[model samples]
Target chain A: MHEDRQQFIQGVRDCLPTLLGYIGIGAAFGIVGASSNVSLLEIALLSLLVYAGSAQFIICALFVVHTPIPVIVATTFIVNLRHFLMGLAIAPAFSQYSMKQNVLLGTLLTDETFGVAASKLTKQTKLNASWMHGLNITAYLCWLLSSLAGAMLGQWIEEPTVFGLDFALPAMFVALLIIQLQQQAAGKLMHLLAVVGYTIIFMVVFSFVVPSHLAVLLSTMSAATIGVLTKR
Target chain B: MTISTTMLLIIIGCCLVTLIPRIAPFILLKKVSLPKWMTDWLSYIPICILTALIVQGMWTAEQGKLIISWHYMLALIPTVIAALWTRSLAVTVIVGVVAMALVRMFS
Candidate 1:
């Protein structure tokens, strides 16, 4: 029991740096939400529930655009569909754990957390619920706190534009993409194909799409199809 | 909609969306094994999906007007550099934010 407690604490410690990043990004999301007429409570609640960086950004953008609720919901669903697959990919690692453990871990499984957790699993043979709980709790707390701070500060700062904060989301995404591309094990051709396919499809479809959701759906479907065909 | 009500609805909606994908695989695939072909395809999904999202986020325009401002171009430099060097999320965000602020100040 003591060993479990120690491992749990260690897991949280390992997750600290990533959690800090989540907090900063989450705070930015909160600021955007508040500026766009979303209440502080709403921002906080969404941060707690969604806990997804990109999805939250997209939803916040939709709010700024005054998009319909159904569109917003559907877009978020499509955008976050990868998380489902990610959950499945990692599920086998936790097969020996209880259902409650599975659900709890699932809630905390963001892209960063999954990458870290999956890598750790590869090096270590044992899978413990405590480590997952600790890592997730640390991330969750950071996200909540940063979002709250953003909400509070957002109320005072009328225009985030004055501080040039509006571009943070895109910048962050760009940085993440660069890193992802750098780590590709499938070779340069795969990377080029993915990039070229995505750009062409996104531009072509986005030009004529009525519901913006179609843009993401069509791009993903077409890209995945191309990836499968060319991978062989 | 009232502020609180909108917040509630958004939260509920996000929760529902997040839960569906996270839980769907476990319930449906508990007894079934994913075929080799499907797994191979799944391996590449992240790269493709994320590339599309990043491109859209970086270049998408509002109201048919392009925004290729100096600030955005300036931010890209540090973002790419930091991502290449550290692969640290915190560093990436900090560098990007700092670059934007500096660009806005100087240009």
Candidate 2:
């Protein structure tokens, strides 16, 4: 127990840099959501619950479109389906953990957490549960605080888009994708196929769709399908 | 438009749908072994979904009009270059914003 606590502290220290990035990005998201006329409560809810950056951005866009409830729900489900895969990919690493521990850790699983944890697992035999938990918790806390700050200050900023804030979400993803491709084995090919498939589906469907939500839903489903079919 | 009860309900519904998938894995994956094929496919979803989103964001205008404007083209130049060279999230986003702003200004 003592050793676990120490390792967890170390994990938090190591993950600090990554956590800072999530804060900045998450705050930007909060600002965007606020600027889109979403209420402070909604922004907070999204920050705490949705947690997925890109999906939150899309949700805000749907809000702007005043999309129907059913469509919005469907779109959110599709966009976040990747989280399921992320959870599964990390399952083997946590096989020894109790179901409660898995559930707790799973709640904190994000792209950043998974990347760091998976890399760590590859290098070491025995997992440091505390450190893993600490890393994820630190990131999650940063995200929540940053989002709250953004929501509070969002109304004061008249033009987030004019400040070029709208570009951050996509830019962040592109950057992350590029880095992931360079570092992970087979990352480039997998990411390239995913991107190409998504783009084709979005372009084909978006033009004819009335509610923009459909474009996101269909594209995400198509991507998931492609991902499932081509898995190693 | 007034904040109608209907709209509020819609928002609540949307929230539930979004939260379920994220929450489900924590519950379901705890006891089950996901098939190998499923695992393989899930790996690719992020890249594909992100690509579709970014391309659409860069190209589409209001009402789905495709605009191959010089501003967008110019913005892409810096974005692509920054993404490939730096591969840093902050750098890429900063460059993209700067590129778009410059394109919007000069054009």
Candidate 3:
């Protein structure tokens, strides 16, 4: 039990970097939701429930455009479809845990948490529910609280874009992806580059015809398939 | 804006859609054994998804016309460098945002 507590604390420590980025993005989100006349409670609930940065932004944008409900729902579904893969990727680590535990843990999984958890898994080679709990819950709390703060403080910041806060998500992703890539074998860099090209091409081509989120799903699946085929 | 019945419905719909995709896979696949090849494929999902998302964020279609934001592209360079050098998410984001703010200020 003591060891579990230690691991859990470590998980939260690992999430410190994410906390900084989340506050910036979450605050930006709060500002948008506030200006859109979205109630503070609703904004907080959206952060609490939806818990996705890009998807929440899309939801706000769609609402601003007055897009139809069904379309908005469908778009959110497609955009979030990738979370299935994220859950799947970490499934093996939690295989020993109960289904209920997995379900609970899965709820806290996000792109940043997935990256952090996956990286830890690659190194630790053991599944500690406490560690995963600490990592995920810390990130989740940061997102929820920071967004709430953003919503409440919405009027204070007029233009997040002028300050370049919009780049937070992409910057985080780029860093995370690079870290993952750096961990791979040098010989596999070429294969990784090819996989990137394959993924981007599929995304660009499919995005023209399909809804943007669906295009992401299709392209990611194709890229993964290509990775599987090329692996020795 | 105040929440209306229609907005509530939309929010619920969004919640259901997000919840199902995120929570279902682990529950459904918990006991089932996945193929080895499938596991291999799963490894690439992160890269593909992140790249696709970043690209989508950097460019978008407006009125059926594709428009690229050169500012984001410019910011990406410094961000990439900082990420590679520091491998710190906080530093990379700070540098990227600063780079972008500078670009927007000048141009």
Candidate 4:
């Protein structure tokens, strides 16, 4: 029991870096949501429930364009379907725990938390429900608070783009890719690079042919499938 | 037609779609067994997804042509260096955002 507490705390501490990224993105989200007239209560609900940054941002953008509700909902589903892979990635760690507990922990598994948790798993070679609880919950709270703060303070934060705040997500992805790579077995980096190469090609070809998000999903699925197949 | 009702409807749709993807995998995994080959595939998903997202942002498609935005690429240089050197996401993001801001300010 004491060990679980310690793990949870460590999970929280590891999330410190994500705090900065989440605040920048989340606050920007709030500013955008407010300007678009999305109610503060609605924003809170989205953060509390939807909890996916990219999807939330897209929701705000789609709202501005007066996108149809069905389209927006469908886009949100496709954009966030990757969350399934992320959930599956970490599922093994909590296999012994009850399904309810697993769902509870998985609810908070954002991109940032998944990256942090996956890295920790690679290094520690052992994982606990406690550590995951700490990481997921801490990051979740930061996202909610930061975006809400941004919404409430939107007047002052008028132009997050002027400061290149939008680049934060891509930058975080770049850093995460590099960090995830650092954990790959040395000689096997070729397979990882193959996946990347395939993704770039697929994304380039598909982006022109299909909606970009679908292209992205296709690229990920195809590249990852090829990656696993080619690995001996 | 009011914003509140429309927004409420949208939010309800979002919550269902969003929650299903995130939560269903865990619940389904417990109930059904996946093949060993499929499990091997999960670990590779992260790199592919992250790559697809980043690379997709680096270029734009124009009228019958493709163009790479050098400014974003230029900004990524420092971000990449910071990521590789410091290996800290906070540092990399700060560098990245500042670099892009500077790039925008200048050119």
Q: Estimate each model's TM-score.
A: 0.77, 0.71, 0.94, 0.93
Model 4, A1-232: lDDT tens digits are 8988998999888888878889888988999888877888988988988899989989988988899999999999988887888888777767777888889877777888887777766666447888888888888899999999999888676777778777888888889889988777888887788778988998988877776778888888888888888897
Q: How badly does each model clash, as a count of residue pairs?
A: 0, 4, 2, 0
Best by lDDT: 4
- Compose the digit string of candidate 3's lDDT tens values, residues A1-232: 8998998999889889877778888888988888876788788778888888888888888887889989888888888888998888777778787888888888878888887777665455447778888988998888888888888888787667887887887888888888877777778978987898898888778767776778788988998898889877
At residue A172, candidate 3 shows an lDDT of 88
| Model 4, runs deviating above 4 Å | A123-126, B1-3, B61-67
Model 1 stretches with alpha carbons more than 4 Å out: A1-7, A54-72, A115-130, A161-221, B1-3, B61-73
Q: Evaluate residue B47 in candidate 1 and report its C-alpha lDDT on the 0 to 100 scale.
A: 50
In model 4, residue pairs whose N, Cα or C atoms come closer than 3 Å (at least 3 residues apart or on different chains), thus clashing, are none
For each candidate, the DockQ is 0.46, 0.40, 0.67, 0.63
lDDT, candidate 2, A63-82, per-residue tens: 78878767766777766665
lDDT of 4 at A188: 84
Q: How much DockQ does model 3 earn?
A: 0.67
- Give the lDDT of residue B82 in candidate 4: 91
Cα RMSD, each candidate: 4.1, 4.9, 1.8, 2.1
Docking class of 3: medium
TM-score between candidate 4 and the true structure = 0.93
Best by DockQ: 3
Q: What is the lDDT of residue A4 in candidate 2?
A: 87
